[model samples]
Target: MKIYRRGVKLDLSIAVVVMFLLLLHMTGMMYKRELHQLFNEEVNISKRGFRRFRSSEIVDKEDETSKVPSEVAEGPAGTKTDHIPAYNMFHQRITKDAMYEPSAFYIFNLLDELATGEISNVSLFPGGSQIKFKIHFKNGNVAIAKPKRHDRGRYWAYDQSEPFWLDNERHNAEIASFHLDRILNFRRVPPCVGRIVNFRKEILPNTKDEEILSTLYINNGNFCFIGNCVPWFCNDNNPICSEGDFMEMSLCVLVYPSVEHPFQDRPFPWSQGIVESEIWKERNICTEMLVDPEITMGRFFLDLMDLAVFDHLIQNYDRHHFTIVVRFNVESFVVIVDNGKGFGNPWKDDTSFLAPIYQCCRIRNSTYQTLLDLSTDGSKLGNLLRLSLSQDPLAPVITEIFFATLERRLGQVLREIDKCIENYGNGEVLVDKVVVI
Candidate 1:
C-alpha cells in the first residue's frame, strides 16, 4: 500500500510541472500576438539582418550622463514606459540647469524688448553666403539679423523634386519658423522677431564691417545696398533696398551663457550632393547610420528621425548640416538653426524631406502623439500657428496659402505613419521606449 501511494504522488508532481511549463509557453505566444495587434506585424529578426537593442537596454554607467527622470524610470506602479526618449533627451540637455533656464515666454518678451531697443553695435556675421548683421543692444544682448529678401505671397518657380534648386532665405520664414517650432512643442529654434529698422540711423551708422559699408548706396531716393556677392547669385545687380529709410528684417536671438558647451557641426547623412552617385534618395542611408559606432552608443538615431519630421512639416529640404552638442561624453543634443531656407514654396510637397521616416521606418511615440493632438478640430496645427504668429510685431508673417499647405502636409505625414504602423507592428515603429541613462 505504501509503494502504490508513492507512485501516485510522483505522477501528480510530474503533471503539475508539465502544466506550469505549458502556461509559460502559452503566455509568451499571447504576448507576441498582442504586440503584433498593437503594431502591424511581428518584426522578423532575420528580415532586419541585425539585432538592435532598445534604448532601455542600452545602459550607461557614468554618473555625468544625463539622468533619466524618476517619472520616466518608474511610471504609475503597474504601467509600462510612459516617457519619450527623444523628448527627454532634448529636455534634459536644455534644462540641465533648471534654476537658470529661461522660460519661452521670458525669452520671447526679452527678444521683443531687445528688438525695440537701440542698436549699440553692428557688424557682418561671417560664413554664410547671404549678408547677415550681428547687432548688439545697449542692454548687452545680441541678435543676428537677416534682411527681408522676398515678398510673402510669392512662390519659387523651380522644380522642388530636383532637391538642388536655387532658393533665397526669407526673413519672414525665420520668424515664422520660431512660432511654428513653439506650436509643435519643440522649442529648438531660438527666439526670433521681425522689426522695421532705419537703415541709415540704426544699422549703417553702427556698421563695423568694411564689406557691408562698401555695398551701401542710394537709389531712387531710397536707401539701397548690395550685399557681399556669393559664388552663385547675390550681387550688385540685385540689391536689397529699403522703403525710404526703414528696412524690414528678422532678428534671431543669440543666447549663450558663460558656460562653454561644446558644439560640433556634423554633415547630414542624406545631404544633397551634386554628383549623381552620391544621391541619398536612392538608398536606405538610415541603415548605415544605425550601424555607426558613435550613433549607436547614444540617441543620435532617434534625434535624426525627429529632425526629419520637423523639417518635413516646414518643407525644409536644405538640412545639409546640423550642430550637435557634445556633453557628458555623449553626442545627444541637436541644436536647430538656419531655418531661413524653409517655407519657400508652399505648393511643392517634397517627399524626399521625409527620408529618415520612410527609410528607417521608425518614429518617437511622443512626437506621434503630439502630432495627433495638434491635428484635431479645435487644436489644428494651422490655427495654432496662425494665432501664435499674429502675436508677433510683424503680424501675418505667412500667407493663407502657406497655412493651407501646412495642414495638408500634416495629413500626409499622419498617413505615412499609419502606413508604417500597418506594415510593421507598433513594437517595431514606435521606438520612444528608449531612456537616456
Candidate 2:
C-alpha cells in the first residue's frame, strides 16, 4: 500500500519466507509418510514372526536346516525340545525278505519248521561279544550239550538257573532286530553272518560290571565234524544224535502250534509276523544263512568275548527265546539259564535303557574290559564302530548299540532317571572308550 517499489531487501525477505514454508511442508509430508511406512512394516513383520513361532509344520519347514529331532526331554544342552515326546523312534521294518539271500529261502524254510514245532533245542551260538541262548520246548529226549561252568546236573527245563539275564523284551528286540539284520546282510551292504542274534543280559551278582550278551543261535556249537558249511540240525527222532558233524543248530519243536504267537510279538498289518529284525549290525555281510552251517560258528574265544546275544532262554517276564528257537528251527539253545534279573529290571522295565546305555559303558567292567582286551587291536573296537556309522545298520554295532540307541531315543529317558548323576555314567554315548592297558 505504501508504494515501496519492491525494495531488494523486501524481495529477498519474501523469497526467504517462501523457501521456509516450502521446506516445512516437505518435512511434514516426509514425516507422515515415514510414520505410515514404519507402522505398516512393523505389523507385517510381527505377523510373520508370530506364525514362525506358533506353527511347527509351517515355521519348522522354514527352519528345516536348523532343527534336530529331540531324543530326550530337554536335552543335556538346554535345548527347548521335549525329546520324550518323540520316544522310541524305530525305522520300522515290515517285510519278510528284509534279507533276500538264496540262503534266506532255506533259512526261512528251516525257521518255519521251528515255528511249526518240528524240532527242539534252538541254540544261538556266540559270535563276538554276544551271548543269548534260549530253550524252545523241553526235549526231555534231547540233552543240554553246552552246560555252563556250574551246572552239575541241570537237564533241559524252563526253570534252569544260570548266570545270564533273560527277559521278554530282550528276546523280542532280538527277534525284531534279526529280521532287520538278515535282510540287510542279504544285500551284503553289511556282513550278516557276524551279527549278534538274541540278546542275553548278564548280571555279575556282587560285581558292578554285569554282562549283556548276544548269541548267534548256533546250529551247532562252534566245533565241526563235517567239511564245508553245514550245521547239523538237532533231530530228536535220531536218539543217537551227536552234537556233531560237528554241530547242527539246536532244534526246537513247537509241537502244538499256538493259534496265537508263542512269543511277545506284534505283526505289522501287511506282513505275516515280525521276528526280531537286526536293524543295525556290526558287519555288513550278505543275509544268507550259512551255506556252510559251520560258517555260522560261535565266537572263537569265550573268555575274550563281552556281551552275550542270541541265547535261546530269556526267562524273565515272558520268554522270547522261544521265538528265536522257532526262527532257527531249534529248541533249548544254550543260555546262562538264570531267572533272577541282575538288577531286577525286566525287559519291560523302565530303566532298562539306562542299564545298557549308562551302566554297561564302563571300560573297567568285566564285560566291557573283556571286549577291549580281547580285540585283535584290544582298542580297535573304535575303528569297527567308526566303519559302522555310514548307513543301513545305522548304529548299534556293538553291545553299546542298545546303549547308544537308547541314549539317543531317550534323550527324554534320561530326564526321569538320574542314574547318570548318581554314578557319573561317564558313559560315552556317541564316542567309544579309549582302553589304555
Candidate 3:
C-alpha cells in the first residue's frame, strides 16, 4: 500500500512541473509578438532596390557618420542624383517647453480680442481674391483679416456685379482647417477664428470708399458685409443700408505671434525639376518622383509622408510649397502654412489626393495605429472634433457631411496601409520613427 501511494504522488509532481513550463513558454511567445509589432522595421523603396532596416539600426548607422554628403558623384549624363543637404533632412525633436504649444481657448480669446480691438494700422495685402488687410491692434498684436462678405460666390473677384466661383469662400474653411489640424496632432496650421464686426465702423474710415465699394457691395438690398450676392438697389428703405450700424460683417482672421526670427523659405529640391513638367502640371506624378538619395532619404521621406497624410485628411491639394523654420540655427522643422484651401465640398471623395501614401506603401507606426483605433470607433473621433470646435465661440463651420467624408477618407487611408502590408511584410511597410528632429 505504501509503495502504491508513493508511485501516485511521484506522477502528480511530474505533471505539475510540465504544466508550469508550458505556461512560461506561452507567455514568452506573447511578449515576443508584441515587441515585434512595436518595433517594426521600415523599408526604403527606391529605383535601386528596397532597403530594409530597423528604426534603431538606422539611427545607429546615421550616428556613426555625423554628416551626410552634400552632393553625390557624377553619374551618366542627365542622370539625376538627390543631393539634398543632410541638415535640411534631419531636425532635432522639440521639447515640450521649447514648443509653441497653446490651448485652443487661449488662442480663441487672443484672436477674438485682436479682431474686435481698436486697430492702430490697417494695410492691404499684395494678393488674393478678397480684400485682405494687415491689421495692427492697440495691444501690439498683428493679424491678417479676411471679411466673409468678400468671399467667393458672394462677391466678384474683379467686379462686384459678377459673382465669384461657387464654394470659393475660404474664411470658414480656414477656421475649420485649423480645428482639424489640432485634432490630428499636426500643430503646423496657425490659429484662426471667426468674428462679426461692423465693417463701416471698423474699416470704412481707415480705407478709401472706392476700394471698399469695389471689394464690399450691397446684395439683395442688404449690405453683404463679407460675401457675394445678387446686385440690388440700396434705397433708404433697405434695412442693412439704412441702418449702417446694423451691418455687421463676419471675418476669419489669422493672428501672428511675434517670433524672434522669421521662418526661412527653402523650395523642395526634388520638386524643382518637375514643377513645370507636364506630369506635374497634370498632377499625375507618382510617389517615385519624391524619393531622395540614401544619404537624406530617411529623414526626407519622414517629412514628405507626414505632409502627404495631413493634406489628404484635409483634402487640401494646393500644397505646392512649404516653409522650413530653422530654430537656434541648428534644429529645423517644416511649418505647414496656407491651409485655407481645404474642406471644399463634403459630397466628393477625393481619395486620389492621397496617392503619395497609397503609392509609397509605408507609414509611421504610431500614426498608422492611431488611424486604426479611430477607424474602429467612428463616434470617438467625431465626438472629439465636435467637442473641440464647439468650444469655439463662432458658429460650427464643419457640417455633418464633412465629418462623414473625413471618416470615409480615413478608412481609405487605412485600406491603403493594409494593402501595403499585404504586399510587403508589416515590418517593411510600417515605419517606427517619423521625425528624427
What are the per-residue Cα lDDT tens digits for candidate 2 across 1-437?
00011112223333333233223222444333433422331221110011101011111112132233321112332334322111111101111222123222123222322222212343433321222333332211111112111111121222344222221112223222333222112221111111111212111111121121121122343311111111221222111112322212222212213223322222211110123223213222222212323212332111111112111111122222211122322221122121222112212233322222332232223333323221323122223222222111112222333323322323323332244335654453212322221
Estimate every model's Cα lDDT from 0 to 1.
Answer: 0.61, 0.23, 0.46
Which residue ranges in model 3 land beyond 4 Å of their true spot? 1-99, 102-105, 111-116, 128-130, 149-167, 207-261, 264-300, 326-331, 434-437
TM-scores of the models, in the order given: 0.73, 0.20, 0.59
Error of model 1, residue 95, in angstroms: 3.5
Q: Pick the candidate with the highest lDDT.
A: 1
lDDT tens readout by residue for model 1, 1-437: 00000011223333333233223222444333433322222221111011211112222222322234521122232333233222222223353212112232134334444446557788877767677878876544567888887788767754754343467778888889887776666666766878778777777777777776777788987787776758553686778788877778888865442235545677777655445326576677766767676655655667677777778877775677766655424544556778887887788887777777887778888778878876776567786676556545566788877878888888888888888999997878888634322
Q: How far is 76's C-alpha from truth in model 1 (Å)? A: 28
**TM-score of candidate 2 on Cα atoms, chains taken together:** 0.20
lDDT (10s digit) by residue, model 3, range 1-437: 00000011213332332232223222344333433322223311110111111111211112223333321221243333233222111111122122223221133334444334455565664444444566655444456765443332232232233321222345666667766665555556555655554444555555553433564566554454332232341222222331343322223333123444455555432232323333444553434344434213334455556666776776664566655554433243456666555666555555655666765666778667767755654334454455444434344556656666777778778888888899987887788643222
Which ten contiguous residues of candidate 3 have the minimum total lDDT?
1-10
Q: Which ten residues in a row have the lowest lDDT in candidate 1?
A: 1-10
> What's model 1's lDDT at 336?
71
Misplaced by over 4 Å in model 1 are 1-93, 96-103, 160-165, 257-262, 276-278, 326-331, 433-437
